[model samples]
Target: MASWSEAVEAAVRRHVAAAGSPFTRQALIDAELDAIVADVGSAGATPHQTLSRELQHLRDMGLLEFFAPGVYRWAGSLDEPMRAGTSKGVFVVGSHSIYQDEPERFYRFGPQWLPNASRIAGNWIIYQEPRRAGPRGYYAVAKVERIVPDPATEGMYLAVIEPGSYLELGRDVAFQFDGKAVERGLLNPDGRLNNGRAVQSIRTISDEDFNRIVGLGLIEDEDLLPRVDDPMPARVQEEHIPWEGPVDRATMLVSRTVRDRQFRKRVLDVYDCRCALTGMKLINGGGRAEAQAAHIKSVAAGGPDRVTNGIALSGTVHWMFDRGLISLSDEGAILLSRKINDIEGVSKLIYPNGRARLPGGVSRPDARYLEWHRRECFHA
Candidate 1:
C-alpha cells in the first residue's frame, strides 16, 4: 500500500493529468482521496480535513502552490491548460486594432503581452473599452478558426473568430449573474474585470460560464444561451424567432435539450460525477464528465424530464438499460439481465453484491420511475 502522502500525490497527479485546469481541493476529494486515505489507515478527521492537511504538507515541500481559494497549481507548471490545442474561456481584447464591428471577423490583441499567448481556439471575447467608457461589457463571442498575421497591423496576431451572438455596447454594464463568480459580479469594485492583472490583457472566465457558452456552440445555442437583457441588440433582431421544423419534432428537440442539460447536472451532482452502479467517473481531457444521464423509463413511454426519473450512468450501462439488459431493483440494487455473461466480460462490471450505491441528494431514484422501468422497459 502507498503511504498517505504518496496516495494523495497519486490522486493529485491523476487529477492534473486528466484535467485541463489546475487541480483543485474539491477535485482531489472527488478524485477518491477517501479511498486513498483508507488504503493506509483510518482518518483521524474527516476526509476534507485530512486532505487539507496533506495538501498543506505538499505545499510546505514546495511541490505546489495555492492558485485560488480551493485551486492548486503544481510547481514548475508550464501553463499546460493553455497549450491544450483548444481552450474555452473569456479573453479581454482592446478595441483599437483590427476589431471589425460591421462584418466582425478577424481581431487582434496583446502583441506586447508577456504572459498570455494564443491557444488552440474556442476563446470568448469580452470587448473592454478604455477606462470608464459608457456601454461597457459589449461582447462578441467567437471561435478562432484560423490564426494568421494581422493584415491591418503586422506586429499582432489576428484571430479569425467564427460568427457568434453579437451585441454592441450602446450602454448598460451592470450584470445580474449567479454561481461563485456571478455572485460577486464580473467586474471588481474598481470597474475592472476580475481574474486578471491591473491592465487586464487576458482573463479566464469562470468554469460555469465557460462550459455553458462552449456547450451552446459559441453563442449560437440561443435557447441555452445566458438570458441577458442586452440593450444593444436590435429590437427586431431580438424579437425574431427562428422557424421550427415541425411541432412534434420541435417539441422533442426542445425537450431533449432541456432534459440533456438539466438531467445531466442533477444526476451527476448526486453521484458526484460517477456511475451509480460501477462507481466509474470517466472524464475527458477537459475534466468534463463522460457519463450519460439515462431515463429510468423510455421517454417514448412517458418518462418525465426529472432528476427522480433519471440515473447517472456510464455509456455501456446506459445502452444496456435502454435495452432492458440491466436495471435496478426497487431497493436500488443493480439487476443485470442474464443476457450479460462472463464470455463477454460484462459480469466483471457488476458490483459484487449486485447492488447500486444510492447517491445522497435532494432528488433520488424515484421508486415509481424504477417500477415503470421494471414493468414496461426492462426485459425482465
Candidate 2:
C-alpha cells in the first residue's frame, strides 16, 4: 500500500491534471483535503498540515513552483507532451462557414501557421474569434491529436482535434479586462501591445495566461441552468473583469458537473422544455421540465456540448433515439427505423407532421450532427 504522503501526492496530481497549472494552496486544500482525510483516516499532522507539507515537498522536488506567497503552479508532468516547459498554443478562427472550421473535430489553417501549430500538437489550445470577424473572443478549448495536410485545400493543414476534448466556453471571454490584455504574451516588454503577435493566426500561450483564460471561460452561470417551460430572460448581465491574481478555478471546465449543466440549460431553454419529437411539454411540481437533453452525437462518440448538437426529448423517446430505434434527418424529418417493434405506437408519439419541432434561428440542430446521427446511429 502507498504511504500517506504518497497517497496525498497522488490525489494532488489528479487535481492538478484536471484543473491545469497555476493553483493556490487554499484551492488545493478545498478540492482535495476531504478526500485525503477520508482515505488516510487521521494522520498525526492533520490532513490539512499533511497536504501543506507535501505541497512544499513537491515544490522542492521540482514538481511545483511557487507563484506567490500562497499560490503554486504545477510543474510536474500531466502527460507525454504536456510535461513541464512544454508550450501550448492558440488557434484563431472566424465563422465556421467561412473557414470550413469544424470546432469539435478539426481546425483549418494555412501553411503560414504549420510550424506554430506543429509545436502545440498533442497538447491543448484555445479557440479565438478575431475582433473584426465576430463577437466571440476567447470562445472554446480543444486538444490537438495531430497535424495533417488538408487534402481539400492546397497549402493548408488541419489540426485534428482529440476526440471528445472540445468544449465550448460557458461564457465568452473578452480580449482584455480592466485595460490589461488577458494574454500578456501579446504585450511587449515596454507594456505596449505587439500588433504583429496580436493578429497571428497561431501563437504560443504561457501556462499562466492559459490557466487564467480557462478559469474565466469556465466560470458557472446560474442563468444557464435548466428551467421548465419558461423562456429565457432577454438579457443576462455579465462581468468582464478578469482575475488579476492566481488562477484557481480551472479544473471544472472539463468536469461533467459543469458541462452537463450548461448543456441541459441551453438545450431545454431553446426547445422551451418541449420534446422535439412529440411536441409534449411536461413540468413537475417543482417546475422542472420532464424533457431531458439528448445529444445527437453523444459525449462518448466525441460530440460537443453545444446546443446545436443536442435535442430535448421525453424519457421514452430519448431511449428509443439512443438505441437506433429512431433518428432525424438534416431537414428535421423524423426517420423511423425498421428495427423498432412497435412502429405504430412510436409513430403515434411523434408530432402529427412527422417532423421535429426545432427552435427557430441558430438554436436548431446542425445538419452535420443530424447527418451523423442518421448515418451512425439510425438502424435504417
Candidate 3:
C-alpha cells in the first residue's frame, strides 16, 4: 500500500493530468482529497497543510511544480517531460530515433520514457531536426502524419512523418537554433542546443519556430523547397560556407518577417481585431490590418511568437502595455500597475469592467506568462 504522502502525490498528479492544466489546493480538496481528509488530518497536518506538503514533496521529486503558491503545471504526456521554466512543445533530448520498420519515417518519443503518445498524436503538422549534422545540412523539416508508441515499451513515442517530408540543406553551411535568433548558427549563446547536436531527435516545434524554420533559405540555393512525397531530398549545390558572413536583409527577415505576420493574424482574429483592453477595433480605410500584435513578454526577453504570448491592441494601448503601464491578470482582469499616475488618461482608454477579453478557442494566455508580466513587466 502507498503511504499517505505517495497517495496525495498520486491524487495531485491525476488531478493535473485530468484538468489538462495546472491545479490548486482547492481543486485537490474538491476533486480527490475529500475521502482522504481524515487520513490526512491524522498525520497532524490539516487537509490544506497535507496537500501543501505533498506538493512540496512532488517539487523535490521533480514530479510537478508550483506555478504559483497554489497552482501546479504538469505535462505528464510527453515521452520526455519538459523541465520547469521551459516552454511547451520543446524537443526532448534522445527521443528521436530511426524507424526500423521503415527508413522513410522517423521516431520522436517524448514527455516521458513511457508517455501517452496520443495526447499529441494528431493536430501537429511539422517536425524539424534541431541539429545540423555533418557537412550537408542545417535542419530537415518534415510533415507529421501521426504518432505511435511501441506497445511493449513504456513512454516509447514516435512522431511518424510522411516519406520525403524532410526538407534538407544540401549546402555545407549550418546554423543552430537560438531561442529566436540564428546568430552565425554555430551554437546558441544560451546553450539550449550545443552545435546542433542536442541529444533528442526532434520534439514538437512551437508555432513561432515552425514558421521561422519554414522560411529559412539554403546557403547556396536560397529558395529550395521540399515536397513530402519525393524520395529524393531537395539539395542545393554544396558550397564551402563559413559560419559568419554578411547576411542580406531578405535572409535576416525569415523568422520575424514571416512569423510576426502570423502572430498578428492569430491575435487579431481571436479578438476580432479589437484591442482587448480598450475594445478599439480601428479600421483605417481598406481591409488592411490595423490591430497590432503586442507581446506580453517582449521579444527582447525571448517570448515565443505564439498567440498566447500576444494580444491584439490599438496603437495607444499597445504602447502603454509594452511600457508596463498595463497588464492582464491571471484571471483575465486588466490591471493598471501603480505607475499609472494619470488616472484621467488611463480611465478614458481602459475598459470600465477592467477584464481583458479572452480568446474563444485555445488562444487563452498562459497564466504563467501572465504572472510573468505582472512580476517582471507590470509597472507595479
- How should the candidates be ordered by lDDT, best one leading? 2, 1, 3
Displacement of the residue 295 alpha carbon in candidate 1, Å: 0.7
User: What tens-digit string does per-residue lDDT give for candidate 1 at 1-380?
Assistant: 23466556545654664573567787778766655654334455576777788889878977678999999997734322222233333455444535543213555653432113344345444434333554333323334555555666654555565543222211213222332322132444554444323234443344454433323322223332212342423421334458863232112223344335444565666677788878788876556676767778666665654566778888778888888888898788877677765524665785667788776543577787798888876765
Clashing pairs in 2: 19-251
Highest lDDT: give the candidate number: 2
Better of 1 and 2 by lDDT: 2
Residue-level lDDT for 109 in candidate 1: 52
**What would the per-residue lDDT of candidate 3 be over residues 17-134, giving only the tens digit for each residue?**
4565677778877887743432222334466776677778777877776788877776344333222211112222212444332212545443232222232343233233343343
The TM-score between candidate 2 and the true structure equals 0.62
> How do the predictions measure up, each by TM-score?
0.35, 0.62, 0.40
With candidate 2 superimposed using the best TM-score fit, by how many Å does residue 238's alpha carbon deviate from the native? 27
Question: Model 2 Cα displacement at 42 (Å)?
Answer: 52
lDDT (C-alpha) at residue 47 in model 3:
62
User: 82-189 in candidate 2: lDDT tens per residue?
Assistant: 222235778888754467788788888765455456667877889888666545789778888888878898756788988777777667788887788898877766
Deviation in Å, model 3, residue 21 alpha carbon: 40
The whole-model lDDT of each prediction reads: 0.53, 0.74, 0.52
